[model samples]
Structure formats: structure tokens, C-alpha cells
Target: MRGWIIYKQNEMLLRQEAYEIHRLLEVAKEENIELQVFSPDQFDLTVTRDDEKSILIDGKRQELPDFVMPRMGAGTTYFTLAVIRHLERLGVYCVNSSHSIETVKDKLFAQQILAEKNLPTPDTMLVKFPVNVALVEKQIGFPVVVKTLSGSQGSGVFLSKSPGEFDDLMQLIEATSPKANIILQQFVKASHGRDLRVFTIGGRAIACMERNSNGENFKANVSLGGVGKLYPITPEIE
Candidate 1:
């Protein structure tokens, strides 16, 4: 069987997890499976055929892969999702559905979905035009986090420890990025300085790690030079 792996090339710098794609491909090859990697811009969905036959592109006919592994990052956005949709139409199995990816990419939407499902998540607010910065402050209070609507690897995220700080940051952000909407959330004190990073696949935890930031940094992302240690997945984590 053949498979296609779609992912962002630049994400390798911030999140080295894309290296795992190579490992996965190696395993697939060991099992005698053919795999191909394509950058988001390389594929053209406009000329794609729907039948279970090969689609011609650039004078070459290529069969639709048996499955597609979407390791798309926030930067890929619409193009990545478009490729997934095209593959789905051609009967390709995606590791994570396009809708699921989209839902998770939107921080506010994800929080709402998790809350509706009775999943524990930090309190968050979404602000659009005519920003009600005061209302957000009254609700989530001080020491809140402000994150871009679409971001990953802890980029475009900021913490406001007080009302004055929050206002100053918001003003600066608004002046620089007038078109951008922000997601403000009440910081989870319990998870402060640390959090659990659990790799879950097929509803099962495979590997887990604990990340603890340095005393000077509040963000515990490994990319941020935070210390990490392998940890066993306990019932509490589940």
C-alpha cells in the first residue's frame, strides 16, 4: 500500500516532532509499504479525479494513496485542509479528520467543544472587533493568557500578570495587528510552571513526558529550552 504524508517544512524548527514522520515512513517501508512526502503547494486539487483510478498531473498518472498522514501545522492552514478534503473525496483515510484538525486549531472553539463535552479546560474568551477588553478582564481576571487565534509551539502567546499589563499588551498588539483577533484565557495556576505532554494515538497513550520550565520562564515548552523527562502514563493522567 502507498501513503502520502503532508506536513509543514518550517515546523521542524519549532516542533521537532516532524522528524517522527521519517521514522513512521521507515516503519512503513520495513513492512513493504510505499510512502511519499509532498509539500502543501505541490498538490493541485482542482484537477483531481474522484474515481478509484489514477489522477493525471503534469503528464504523469498517480494513484491516490491508501491513506494520508496530516502533520500540518498552523501555517499551512487552508492549503493543508484543502489537500485533506481532496484526498478524502478520493477515498483516502486520514489519520485525523480535517474537521477535527480545524476544531483543534481554533483555541477558542476547542475550549468550547471541550467544555461542552464536560472536559476540563482553562476559562477562555474570544474578542472580535470593538474589543470589549474590560469585559474580558472582568470575566477571566488578571494573570490571564493572550494567544493568537491560530498558533502553535507556544508562539504568539503572552501572559498578563495584572490588569495594567494586560491593557498595555493588548494596546500594543492591536496597534501592530489591527486585523487579528485574540483568545484570552484564565491561566491555570495548578498547571503553572509545568504540564503533561501525552502522545495519544487511536485513543491510547503511547509515550508521555513531563515538562518543567526554568525558574525564569513561565512557558514549559521544550523548544523554549525547558527541561523535560520521560514519565509513565498513570491513571491520573488518563
Candidate 2:
């Protein structure tokens, strides 16, 4: 058995010590599966005149893996997605389908889908220029959470404690990126300094953790100085 993990080569190299990739490789070894890692740029895709699809890795034809796992998250670019799509065409199964990844990359679209499914989601509104402060006050209220449409690891996220702060932040954003895509969400005070993180595979919850802010920031992201610990997976969390 063989598999591939698609991640940036540079990042993998930098974090090679005590990284998730090493753990995955170890598990694969125990299972008698030869798991390999490849950067998106390593593969060259081609479609032949006879409708045959072929991919070359490092400029040489190579055997396809039984499955692929794209782990780039927000770092995933159009080219990366294109590579994944090409892999799919060649009948490679990918964890977290490309379509789902694309949809969730857009914050508003993901929230809308969750709400439509009757999931309990914070009230969210897409922001537009010549901003509607009145509507925001009435609908979302103060102390809102502002976020860029596509971000990960708590980047491009901000908390506006009042109308003035929100206005100032929006003006700054407009001055720098006039056509920036942003969203406003009603802040959930109950989860202010901490939140539950759940990991799922095949639609089943496998692990749970709690992330707490470092007593300074509102975002409980470990990359931003947050602390994490194992947490019980209760029925409600599931």
C-alpha cells in the first residue's frame, strides 16, 4: 500500500523536527504502507490526445498513490487545487475533497451552508463598502468579530470592541485593500478566551482539545500564543 501527503516542501523541511508528517509516516510504516510527501510543484500533469491522463513527478513518470492528503489549508492556491483536481481525475482518493475545501475557504459560504443545515452558527454578515453601520448595530451589534474571507491559524482575524474601533479598522482596510472581502460575526462572549477544537475523520469525531488564550489575545490559536490540552468529547461536542 502507498499514499502521499501533499504539503509545501520548504515548510515540511523547516518543521521536520517533531512535526505531524513524521508521525503520519511512522503510522504508515507500522501499517506496512509506504507513505511519501510531495510538494505541489513536483508534479507535472498532462492529458493526452487519446484522453489518457498522466502525471510526471520530478520530471519523470511515477506510479500513482492509493490515496492523497492535501494539508496546505489556507496556503492552498489555485495551482495546488488544480493539481488535486488532476489527481482526482486519475482516480486518486483525497481526504477532505477539493470541492469542500474550496467552499469552506470562503468564510461566508461555509457559515451559510452550516446555518442552512440547522447548525448553531454565530450570526454573520458579509461586509461591503460605504458600510452599513446602522444595519450592523441592529443585526450584529458591537464587539463584533471581523475576518477575511479566506484565512487560517487565526490570521486575518480581528475583534472590534465598539463601533468606533470597527469603523477605524474598516477604513484602514479600505485604504490598503479597497476590494477586500471581509465578514462580521456576532461575538460569542461565552467562548471569549477559549474554545473547543475537534478533529474528525470520515465524519466521525476522533480527538478533542481545548485552546485557551494566553490571557491577552481574544484568539485562542496556538500559533498566536494559545495553550491547548486534551478535552473530553461529550455528546454535545460530537
Candidate 3:
């Protein structure tokens, strides 16, 4: 059967999702499953006679694949999900269905879902316009963590110890990306400079690791120069 993997080409250089895609493709090739890369830039959507169509690369005319894997990044979110939904409408399977993926990709929304499911998570608050920095400081207290609503690899995460510091940082961020919205949260002091990196596939933990940050860094993301040690998954992780 034929399948396509869709992902942002630019982010493939450093993202772990890219590596996961490569591994899946390698396995597919070994198993004799037809696999192909479907980049967003290589296709255009059109609707004719109440039927949707995609114009693919190399000027080839083709129907949708048997399945699609969306490894898209934040930048290509809307288009990637649109394509995935289109494929689903055409009877194609998607690893994470568009709606489910969308829910997880949204940080605040995901936190809410987890909270509803009684899963433990850091206390978080989504903030928009008319934000009162003083009120936020009073509630979450000093040394709070701020993050953009949509970011990966700790790109938009920041630690602010004071209202003035938070304002300054927000000013800088606004000057750069004016459209950005953010979330404020109580920093997990116990988890300071460390966290568990658990990889789950098909609802099972496949790989696990413990990551510790370098000196003075709070984020333990490997992309941010943190060191990681492979660990066996305990019952808690599972």
C-alpha cells in the first residue's frame, strides 16, 4: 500500500520529528510498503465538480494515498491539517487524526484536557489582551514561567522573577512577533533543571530518558545544550 509523510522541509534539519519520520520510512522501505514525501510547497488544492483534488509535484495526477503521516511543524499547521483532513475524507488513514493532533498541539488546550482527565501538570493560565502583569505576579508569584501558546523546543519559554522583568520580556517579544499570545504558569520547582523525556508510540512508552540542564538553565531540552541519559521506563512512566 502507498502512503505519504508530510512535514515542514525547513524544520527537518534539527527536529526530532524529522528523525522519527526517517526511521518510519526506513522501516516501511524494508517492509516493502510504498512511501513518499509530500511537502506542502509541492502541492496545491483545488475543488472541481464538488470533488477536491491535489496537484502534486512532477505534474503527476493522482488520488490520495492509502495513509498519511503528518509530521508538520508549527509554521505549516493549518495547511498540514487541511491536507490531512482532505486525505481522511478520501478514506486515507492518518497516524494522529487531525482533530486529535490539533488538541495536543495546543499547549493550553492540552493542559486543560489533561486536567480534566486528572493528570498532574503545572498550574497554567492563558493570557490575552488587557493583561494585568501585577495580578499575574500576585497569583503565580515570582519566578514564573511564560510560554507562547504555540512553540516547540523551548523557543518561546521564558523565566521571569519580577513583574518588571516580565513586562520587559513581553515588550521585546511583542516588538518581534506582535501576533504572539502567551501562557503564564507556576514554575515546577521540584522539577527544576530536569524532566523525563518519554517517547510514546501507539499509546505505549517505547523509549525513555532523563534530561538535566547545564548550570543555571531551567529548561532541560536537548536542543538547548542539556545532557540526557537513557533510562528504563518505570511503572510511573508507563
Candidate 4:
């Protein structure tokens, strides 16, 4: 089988995870899986009046891979997902379908969908201009999680520990970014700045890691200096 991994080339190279990538490549080679890597920026899409489409990567028309795994975290969402959608039109299967990924990428939308389905989700309130600090407090209480519409590695996510903090953060955001989209989410106090990071593929979590904020921050994000420890997948995690 042949597969493609779509990733940000420069970022991954800078992170120096080449050894990890090489190990995966070696395993794939042994299994007769032809896996190739392509940066998201390399693709150009062409659409025609006849409702036909083709792609040019590096200025050359390319053959479609059997499967595609987009490794993008938070940036270039629309562009990369567009390519994934386009590939789907050509019958290529994405590890996570473009539609599903696109839907879940929007924090508010995901919550709304989950709540509608009666799925367990944090209580959240989407803010409009002139955000009501009192209403936010009444809905989510103090020490709430405030998250921007787009963020990764816990960036743009803040914890408002008090009513005053919530007001200040909301007012600052309104002043600086009048049109910023944000949400106030109820904090789960029991978690205590720690969470399980589950790595899922084909709908099963194959590996897990526990990330702790190191008692320095409220967001236990690896990019934010959180310590990680390999963990076992448990029934609760599933």
C-alpha cells in the first residue's frame, strides 16, 4: 500500500524529529508500505468549468496517493484541508476525513455539535462584542478556560482565575482585536492542570502520554514547557 503524510516541512525539520520519521519509514518499508512525505504548501489545485479538477505539486501534475495523513496542528487549516477534500474527489482516503477534521477544528462548533448529540463537553459560552463578564461568570464560574478560536500547543488559551481577571482579559481582547472570536469554558477543577494526550489513528488510541503543567502554568501543553510521561491506555481514556 502507498500512503502520503502531509506535514509542515520547515517546522518538522526545525523540531529535528527526523529520527522518528526515519524509524516510521523503515517500518513501512519492511511492511511493503510506500510512505511519502509532502509539505502542505507544495500543492496547487486547478478547477475547470467541466467540474473536473487536478493538482500540481511543485508545478507538476501529480499522481494521487492511496491515503493521506495531514499532520498539521493548527496553522494552514483551510489550505491543507482544501487539498485533502480535493484528493477525496479523486477517491483518495484521508486518515481523518476532511469533513470531520474541519468540523472539529472549530472549538465552538465542535462543542455545539457535541452538546446537540448529548455528548459530554465542557460548558461554554461564545462571546459577542461587549462581552458580559457577569454572564460569563454565572455560566462558567471563576477560574474558567478562555480560548481563542484558533490555537494549538495551549497557545491563545488562558485561565481567568477571578472575575476581575475575566473582565480584564475580555476588555483587552475587545480593545486589541475587536473581532476576535473567543469562548469561555467551564474549568474542570479536578484535572488540576493535567491531562492525557491520546494519539489516535483509524479511530483507536494506540498510545497515550500524560502532560503536566509542571506547577508553573494552568495549561498542560507540551509546547508550553509541560512535562510528559508515557502512559498506558485505560478504559477511561477510551
Candidate 5:
């Protein structure tokens, strides 16, 4: 058995996630499945006149793998998504389906879909110029969580504790990036400084990690100075 993990092999492999990916590779090897790392920018997809689709890895055509693991980051999201789409055309299965990824990649779009499905989520509003402060206060209230549409890993996220703060934030954002896509989400006041990160696979909860700010900051993400505590999965968490 063979598989591929699509990622930015050059840069990301040097970060903390490198250990995670290496562990995956080691586990795969133990299971007699060869899992290779493949960079998103290192491949080219070609469609032939004979209606055959081929992928070139490091300038050489390669056979399609049994499965794919997508680790596409913010920088090459669209290009990697396109590559994943092409891979699906060649009958390769991805851990996360391409269409679902696309939907969630766009923050507002995903929220809209969730809202339509009646899933519980924070009330959110997409930012608009000449902003409606009244509507924002009515829907989101004070202490707003402002986030860029495509941000990840605690980047491009901000908080406005008051209406004045929100107004100042908009001014700064407009001055820096006039057309930046943003959204205002209601603050979950009770969840402040602590949150749970649950890992799910194949529609089943596998592990749960609690992140605590330790009174250092409002964000409870371990990557941002928070402490992590792993817990056994339970029915409530599931």
C-alpha cells in the first residue's frame, strides 16, 4: 500500500509539524504502507489528447497513490486545491474531500452553510465598508472577534472589546488593507482562555485536547503560549 501527504515540503517540514508528519510516516512504515511526502508546488498535472490524466513529480510521471493527505497552508491554498481536484479526477481518495475543503476555506461561506443546516455556531457578520455599527452591535455585541476570511493558526485574528475599539480597528484595517475580507463573530464569553480541540476521523471522535491560556492571554491555542492537556474521548465530547 502507498500514500502521499501533500504539503510544502521545503519550509513546513522544518517546523513543529515536521515531527507530526514524521510520526505518521513511521506509523505507516510499521503498517507496511509506504507514505511519501509530496510538495504541492513540485507537481504538474497534464491532461493528454487521449483523455489520460498524468501527474509529474519532480519532472517525472508517477503512478497515482492509493490515498492522499492534504496539508495545504494559507499561501498555496487555491493551487493545492486545484491539484487535489485533479487528483480526484484520477481516482485518488483524499482524507478531506476537495469540495468540503473549498467550502470551509471561505469562512463566511462555511458559516452560511452551517447556519442553513441549523448547526450551533457563533453569530457572525461579514465586514462591509461604511460599516453599520448599530447592526453590528445588535448582532455581534461588544468584545467582537474579528478574523480575516482565510486566516489560520491564530494569525489575522483580533478582538475589539468595545464599540470604539471596533471602530478604530476598522480604520486601521482600511488604512492597511482597504479591501481585506473580514468577518465579525460573536464572542463566546464563557469559553474565554480555555477551549477543547477535538480530533475526529471517519465521523468518530478519536482524541480531545484541552488548551488553557493559564491566565496569560484570551486565546487557548497551544501554538500561542497556551498549555495543552490531552483527555480520553467521552460521549459528551463526541
Candidate 6:
């Protein structure tokens, strides 16, 4: 079996050990699978007569892999998505379909969809220009979780413990990125400083782990110096 792991340009080149790509390649090697890493820029999609499609990677035509895993995180660009869509048209399976990625890329849209399906989700409100801090307090309450529309490793996430803090953060965002898309969620106090990270494949949960901030931060992302331990899958996590 063969697979391709797509990531950002510099990330793959640097071969960061902290990133999942390294671990994935190691596991693939143990399993006797040919797993190659490629940045989106390395791909060139060509469409010819009869609607035939082919790909050139690193200036050379190559056979498509059986599957492709895109690990571009929040930096997923339209061109990369187009490349993945092209791969799909060429009959290669994408671990996470492009449609799903597009849908979830907008945090508010993903939450709305989940809420629409009767799934339990935190009460969320989209942030707009001239944010109404009072309204957020009324709807979501204090100590809310503010997150940019797209982010990973807890980079764009914040814990606003008070209206003043929330307003201050909004002001900073306005001064820097006035057009940034963001959301405010009612903070889950029960999960403060810790959360579960679950990996799923083929519509089923395969592995689960707990991440902790050691009470140092509200975000428990491994990229943020948090610690992780194996966790048993429970009904709630499932």
C-alpha cells in the first residue's frame, strides 16, 4: 500500500519531529507501506483532452497513491484543496474529503451544522466589527473561549475571563486584523486546562489521548508545551 502526506512547504522540508508527519511515516514504515511526504507546491495538476487528468510532482509524472492525507492544518489554501479535489477526480481516496474540510474550515459553520443535527455544542456567537461585549456576556457569559475561524495547536484560541479582557482582545484584533473572522463560545469549565484528543478513521475512533496544560494555560495543545497521555475511549468521547 502507498500513501501521500501533504503538508505546508516549510514544515515538510524542516521535518519537524514534533509534528504528526514524522510519526505517521514511522508507523507506515513498520507496516511495510510506502508513505511519501509532499508539499502542495510540489504538485501540478494537468487536465487534457477527453477530460483526462494527471499529476506531476516535483516536475515528474508519477503514479497516484492509494490514499492522501492532507495535514495543512489551518493554513490549508484554496490551491491545495483544488489539488486534493483533482486527486479525487483521478480516483484516489482522500482521508478527509475536501467537502468536509471546506465545511469545517469556518468554525462558526461547523458549530452551526453540529447544532442543527442536535449534537451538543457550546453556545457560540460570531464576532463582528464593533463587537458587542455586553451581548456576548449575556449569551455566552464571562470567561468565554474566543477562537479565530481557522487555527490549530491552540494558536488562535484565548480564554477571556472577563468582559474587560474580551473587549481588550477584540480591540487588539481590530487594530491588527480588522477583517478577521472569530467566534465566542461559552467556556466549558469542567474541561478547563485539559481535553481529549481523538483520532478517527473510516468513521470510527481509533485512538484517544488526554492533553493537559498542567494548570499553566487554558489551552491543552501539545504544540503549546502541554503534556499528553494515552486515554481510554469512553462513551462520551465516542
The digit string of per-residue lDDT tens for model 2 on 20-103 reads 777888899999998888889988877654544346988987878889989878888998899898888788899867997898
Task: List, residue by residue over 1-238, the lDDT tens digit for candidate 5.
Answer: 8889887784335456576677887899899998888888888867655555457987997888999988765544777888898888788898787887787778899999979988678999999986777889998898899999986667787778999878988988888888999999999888898888888888788999988989957788667788889877788777
Instruction: Arrange candidates by lDDT, descending.
Output: 2, 6, 5, 4, 3, 1
lDDT of 3 by residue, 122-183 (tens): 88988755567888877787788998888777788888988888878877777777777788
Ranking 2 against 4 by TM-score, winner: 2
In the range 74-106, model 6's lDDT, one tens digit per residue, is 688999999889898888899788888888788
For candidate 4, the lDDT comes to 0.80
Which is the better candidate, 1 or 5, if ranked by lDDT? Answer: 5
Q: Candidate 5: count the clashes.
A: 0
lDDT for every model? 0.77, 0.86, 0.78, 0.80, 0.82, 0.85
Each prediction's TM-score versus the true structure: 0.85, 0.92, 0.81, 0.85, 0.90, 0.91
lDDT of each residue in 3-69, candidate 4, tens digit only: 8877788334534554445666679899999988778888887755444434688798776777887
Ranked by TM-score, top first:
2, 6, 5, 1, 4, 3
**How close to the true structure is residue 130 of candidate 2, measured as C-alpha lDDT?**
67
lDDT of 1 by residue, 1-238 (tens): 9887776643233245565777877798899989777667666666434355554333466777888888876665787798787778777899888888888888888899889988788888886655666787788887888899988778888888987777777777778888897988888887777888998888788989999986766788877778889999898777
The segments of candidate 6 whose C-alpha lies over 4 angstroms from its true place after superposition are: 10-12, 49-53
Off by over 4 Å in 2: 10-14, 49-54
Candidate 2: lDDT of 46?
Answer: 78
Task: Tell me model 2's lDDT, rounded to 2 decimals.
Answer: 0.86
For model 5 the TM-score comes to: 0.90
Off by over 4 Å in 3: 10-18, 47-58, 171-179
* Candidate number with the higher lDDT (1 or 6): 6
Clashing pairs in 4: none
Alpha-carbon deviation at 193 in model 6, angstroms: 0.8
lDDT of 4 at 118: 85
Better of 2 and 5 by lDDT: 2
